[model samples]
Target: MEDAYTHKDLAALCSVSETTIKSYRRKFPGFIPVLTRGKPIRFRKEAGEVCLKIRDCFEKGMSVNETLAELGKHFTPRTGAAPSPSPSPARSQQVVSPEYLDKFFETAGKMMQGMAALATAQAKAGQRLEKVEAVLDKLLEIEARNGERFNELLTKVGSPSPDIPPTASSSGDGAPSRETVRARKIVNVRGSEGEVRSYALEKEADKATGGLEQPPGSLLSTPIVIRNDQDEFLGVPGRLPLSGFVEILVREAEEDGASLSRWERAGEAWVFVMDLTGGGSHALYFTATTTPRGNQVALLERLDVDGKETTPQFLQEFFRQVKDKV
Candidate 1:
């Protein structure tokens, strides 16, 4: 059985605005409050609700850090798997009851509505900002005209008048606008001893040395974006396949301090290796993140060795030998 509370009561307990509560619910589908005809609404009294909120935040593109901050908690040390005693009896009394849960869902519904409302509000604000900016420009132009006329009138009347003040110090009209600048990291993985990233984009027709042509069936190079925990794009790279034995030039070294791990299958077991090039010359760490992807992909991961597994250090050396010839 559930004890129910009204929308207002739940809002007070959650320490969030009714509007905010509604927004939170909108992110997660199918959130409902238990309600009764004559009594208040009821809500679940478990941390499960909070957990779901965290998941929803992640799906909505919020980072783990953002999720923690939203729930008003700090990082706690993890404990080994073991049962712990329940909270003190007095503390349990303060926990949210089912009645409060009902209210929480109600607020959650409103929050979803509010999020929709907020999107609408943001669009409206953008329009309003543009309008205000336009109006301000017009007003400033009018002021300019009025000042000219006033000064002329004063001179004709043989009266002394003060000069009009220039535009406000706070005015942004003449100031340069700013935007976030993102640095582009490009890795030039040109095979053999050659120019940076192959000046083969066709535009450098005049300056590029074409004495060296790529051997047939060589790497058809392309780039992939490296993304951060925040989903912000960090670098563009062309990862050389170990099969091709091509050397990789890691550009923008500072941005690439973190190593990248790769997984592949060899025979029955799956193998993994990480690019530890930045760590040292011919250095790599190997581990398994999962089992092999069957014989089909395993053929691709096989090496000239026992056709078993491979480490990143071997890969770097294999490609280095290729570069040494040219």
Candidate 2:
């Protein structure tokens, strides 16, 4: 769990910037933790707990943007709610009716205005956003932490019964074969919509094995030549047959590179996020999560493309169709 979610990890998971997180900590209390006052890491258990609640609140009715907007409404005291309190009450009271009342009030008012301006300014910074993001990250971190403990217990349970060889999905090789097929026509398995057949592996990348990993697919950014059956260059996603391809690459992809989604073997199928930047359209990229149940796993996901939704049933069929064709 923690292994998969470092600062870089959470950034990728939450789709935000790390620097933004650091900035948030400076503004919001414990938004990001610096336990020993060193470099920051995920908030610990307490903050994590709050995050879950905040996120639940957000997901059920608000988006990050919406949550921030709501938070911003609380960003400052309302009109007449509290005029700027002086840094010190004794000094502040003196200003209320002293010789310097008018001057002091004016000066203090300016100072308060300056500070308020500063606080508001900080809030708008990406770092301020990070503070809010940290709240959300907290939930993931908690779940991740629990997942770690569960895995530990499972590992402690030791290998499966000798009679039961753990039946698990195959791992990937992270390599590309020359036989990579150009847009082999794919037809969507969904009952709705038009043909969406996926191009299967033109040739066997490698033979199947119980524990053998398949070569990981090229990263999402790795450009692929999408051609027609005649092998004519059809420049991804434009013109006839909608031929074109763009690989989605996780910024942290390995040397050979694969999307974070496909870097690990989840279950029966390796996954990748949708390369939805125009050319990468058509080939579905996967995002969402999967739950492991004994030897099998099931994903909770939607298509990576904008304005497209997919059911888990469709996802399973799509992967199967790809695997079978490949």
Candidate 3:
């Protein structure tokens, strides 16, 4: 039987807080497999192997986004849930028991193993399969410290198999690809009443205090570009698209005398608490989501800061200074 572990085991192995693991689970949905769900979540032993890699990436100074991208190479989600092997006539009549569940899981593991083998065969012969083998080996570990937890969590949630979609980097040797980090376009924005303001992103040199540059597109800030209703070039939403913007926002908040109480990757967004200037604290959200227009948009919001809602003017000023010195 493949080994199973709890959140505590993964945290201790990765030298990260349990909260951090939960954040990883939320942010990178398809990356790790949850053997059991609900409170006090349990993970497959393979999770620990992946966590170890994540820890190494962080220790090497790679950001959360970068770490996930790196992990994409070795970990590939199965197309569908693992299929159960054919049962014998007598076995079919027998009542399902713990041993039967273990056998079923074993079959699923073999399915994964077959897929991995096929991947190896597709790769160039004599290629260094160190990383791939290591991940598979760790996944096949027989430690079952939390079998009961798995039984319960899986009982509540139908199947144990994950249904995450595969990424471009999940196949082959996992070479770095521009497709993995493509810049998402944010063409235009529509207000509450469908009032639209169209805009385009243009690259420009980062200037000190220069207002607008020619071509009406160059923002002269970070690689990201966005404009307001008045066609005034605003700074990048956060700094870069996705989590990169979150990192910049965190740095800016800290530099602006906001003490960071906590930060975590929340679902498709990054949520963090900032004790702002003048002895007040607020929750800051850096969210990236796909717009209805098929473009990705990065949004920054301050929630209930000092008992005051974030105003439109405040957002405008915030965007203008998002990349003040950068």
Candidate 4:
């Protein structure tokens, strides 16, 4: 009977890791015949020599196809038949010809040189990609700064100019002008519903008066409450006109002692970095857009904490507080 070797035994005999031995068995299945398919899988003694031969070919810069061809010249591939008895260790050792050793070493040295060059090329490519990534990050930062500046400009433009006098055209009695009186009348017309009705009423007033009325006060002073189709209070509207229903999350965050920094503006969304009291930080993206029903609302578009995306559930309490406060 031929000597049988477990994977570990074969690994020791071939001076390779057990993982490498298993890889050889997988890559050259026909050449490494299993004597027992059970646990601690045992292979024919010849599998050890085959592993060594495959390793030598690989080290000698031969591709799998080339190694298979070379193997065919040295040993008959197993055909799933019972393996014939292999020669004793001494006899097998003597079978390795001197010409094979010389050829193996010569090819392996060339392969090593080629592998070193490939590694150097890969390192250079990796460095180039890192540089490109850095540039993109810088560009994104610049874009965000620009957007923030643009937002500031828009806010400034929306404000009442100190240089311009009131255009109410007051009557001699110092009473409000006819247009102002008409605009105020339009504003006072209340909808059956509470705040939501007022928002609609104000829009009508704006259209009727040709925007002569001063831009409404800060959201903090005159917070307009909105609701969804389900009649749930969505929160107070923000002053960002372009965004339909912008919420005043910044005010809420600031009240909680969270330091906030404005980041980039992505589309209609403004990204902010909020640093909490616990020394943790989060990326909060607030998207301002008009609802299909023509309501302006700010939404918490996305939230990221410590570089990981998370559900807004973390801020549910904070949001609840904002709603209650409003």
Give per-candidate clash totals: 15, 26, 0, 8
Q: What is every candidate's alpha-carbon RMSD to the true fold?
A: 35.0, 34.2, 38.7, 20.7
In candidate 3, position 305 carries an lDDT of 68
Model 2: per-residue Cα lDDT over 2-119, one tens digit each: 3222355444444457664444333344333333333444344333333333344455785443443444443432343323222445754664576756797799999999999999
lDDT of each: 0.39, 0.38, 0.55, 0.59
- Compute the lDDT for candidate 4: 0.59
Q: Can you give the TM-score per candidate against the true fold?
A: 0.15, 0.19, 0.26, 0.25
Report clash pairs, candidate 3.
none
lDDT of 1 by residue, 1-326 (tens): 43444445456655555665555434422232334535444444332355356556767997543555555442221233122223466765557787898999999999999999999999999999999988966864565456555444323332221232222233267652222211122233456777555111111211111222221121112111222335333222232332222223232222456344333433443333334445532222221121232101111222333333345456445434434433
Greater TM-score among 2 and 3 belongs to 3
Q: After superposition, how far is residue 57 of candidate 1 from its true place, in Å?
A: 5.7
Expressed as tens digits, the lDDT of each residue in 1-326 for candidate 4 is: 35999888988887889999888866666788789888878888788788889889999998666677677778787787333344466765677877999999999999999999999999999999999988966864565456656444434433343344344666899875554532111112345676432211112223222333222222112223333446454554342221222234555556677654345555655565656765777675665444565544445556678767765555454445545554
Estimate the TM-score for candidate 3. 0.26
- Scored against the true structure, residue 108 in model 1 reaches a CA lDDT of 100
Q: Predictions ranked by lDDT, top down? A: 4, 3, 1, 2
In model 3, what is the error at residue 234, expressed in angstroms?
A: 6.6
Superposed model 2: Cα runs more than 4 Å off: 1-100, 126-128, 131-191, 194-198, 203-326
